[model samples]
Target: MWPADIEATARAIIADFTARGLKVATAESCTGGLIAAALTEIAGSSSVVDRGFVTYSNEAKIEMLGVEAATLAAHGAVSRETAAEMAKGALARSGADLAIAVTGIAGPSGGSAEKPVGLVHLAAAGRRGKFVHREMRYGDIGRDAVRLATVRTALGLLGEISQEP
Candidate 1:
């Protein structure tokens, strides 16, 4: 279940991608498969949604999305580097023309001086090297709020990437 704005955005993406004959894949970490779930929640989403990877753990990110261990080691799982790699990997592995990745620490815990609980990194990659990255600091919001905000931002990134020629 998604809010009205989120569901609307997902529907718009599905329709636009279908019209453009473009497909998308998702590689998710903290938001799990919510991006994919949002897209697939719409009717006829199968035409635009290729696959979804719920890579919640480091091993899953490495194994499923081909995220490098070194990148994870250097930048941690929630960094821009890992998010970009995840997006690129998803695009390479799937039939989709576009891919988006989301990694974050959404928690009442897991806060550090550098990486706080509401810190999120999102990346979108498209064919022909089209890419975009966004880092959001949503403050110490509740876990659900943080995750929902992430889904919204991730969808926006996908929309932005889709606009590229």
Candidate 2:
């Protein structure tokens, strides 16, 4: 995912959100703060980026994003349920108009028969009852690559959410 054009996508997303007068927040797991970093790379992103949470651990997700312990225990952090909850929690916690959450296994070790490495779950939640979720199989790209892909997907989700009616 590193080689992806993530910065360009993030810039476009920031421009769209700014144009729409929307504030954004991020809850990140496998990608850490890469999505936030990408957004802040733009000069005036402060107007749109409310905050970012790098909830790399289950406890942090529960504590910071209000992801329920039962959700994590039942579906694991990489599931769509966790991602959706994370997005909603970020929105509630930061008071942002829009939020994106990403959780994934970007690893050389975490791959299993069912949930393999590079399996990323992404979700976006907006104030207007807009919800978007996606599962991506990037196919064991390196950790940096997978994380970069996840960031790109997250930013793209923000862009799409801003366009929703």
Candidate 3:
């Protein structure tokens, strides 16, 4: 089952974007299609959400979102560079005014010494070339928590983009 607050936040984001005449898209990795699912749970989300890309694998990220293989090799799939490229590619591939990308290691076993579990990289890109990225180290918050947090943050980013000039 989905988080309870996610639906509320998704509705708010959809309302804000629809009011402002902005269309939104998502490029998701660790969270799979949860963000898209949350947004689509709202009744009028179709007016604001143009598309969603569930690029859960490096190959899928490369093929669907045009993420560079060099970038993936250099910084792995959970880096800011990859997230930015994912957001940019999503925006370019969709008819949305803004796009959000999420990539992370949300697991109980993928934790390394350097990049532990719950190290999420998020990015938001706009058609006007404006881009914003954030690196979140949520520690070993479990897979479910990490994915829920990522979805919440992604919706917040969409809300923030709606308020931008």
Candidate 4:
């Protein structure tokens, strides 16, 4: 039930993280924990994946990841700010060495003039205070495609961070 590219990325993340003796957590919105799912599909991911938070709603993001209501109101859930907050929260709350967060609109609907569908914001944070964020516009790529693309990018972020000394 996982894409090949995503599965490959996840396996690489698991390998890199395990080698580094680091753990990972995920805070997901649009991808709905698909990154976590991909990692867990690996045979030995338990040694690397700490947890996955499927914060699919604004309320869940607030309660689970400490995303502020004001932040959501000001920038909406799909913005980079919210994605950063979600990443920090996951890193803090899950006690993982690194965490990845994703938020987005992926759909045949939910498009606006400003924030259209297939707009995804991603963030990765490390406990040592390193952080990275990205804004991806997959552009009406369909929900499944957007979500899969998101998982790939998230895993890539995790891989990148894992390589850091």
Candidate 2 backbone collisions, by pair: 1-145
In terms of lDDT, the poorest run of 10 residues in model 4 is 1-10
* Highest lDDT scorer: 1
Off by over 4 Å in 3: none
- Show the colliding residue pairs in model 1: none
Q: List runs of model 4 lying over 4 Å from the truth.
A: none
Q: How accurate locally, in lDDT, is each candidate?
A: 0.94, 0.89, 0.90, 0.90
TM-score (all chains, Cα) for each model: 0.98, 0.95, 0.96, 0.96
TM-score for candidate 1, residues paired by index: 0.98
Write candidate 2's Cα lDDT for 117-143 as tens digits.
Answer: 999999999988999999999989799
Task: State in Å the error of residue 116, model 3.
Answer: 0.5
Candidate 4, residue 142: Cα displacement in angstroms equals: 0.7
Candidate that beats the other on lDDT, 1 or 4, i.e. the better one:
1
Rank the models by TM-score, top first: 1, 4, 3, 2
lDDT (C-alpha) at residue 51 in model 4:
95
RMSD after Cα superposition, model 4 = 1.0
**Cα displacement (Å) at residue 151, model 2:** 1.2
TM-score winner between candidates 3 and 4: 4
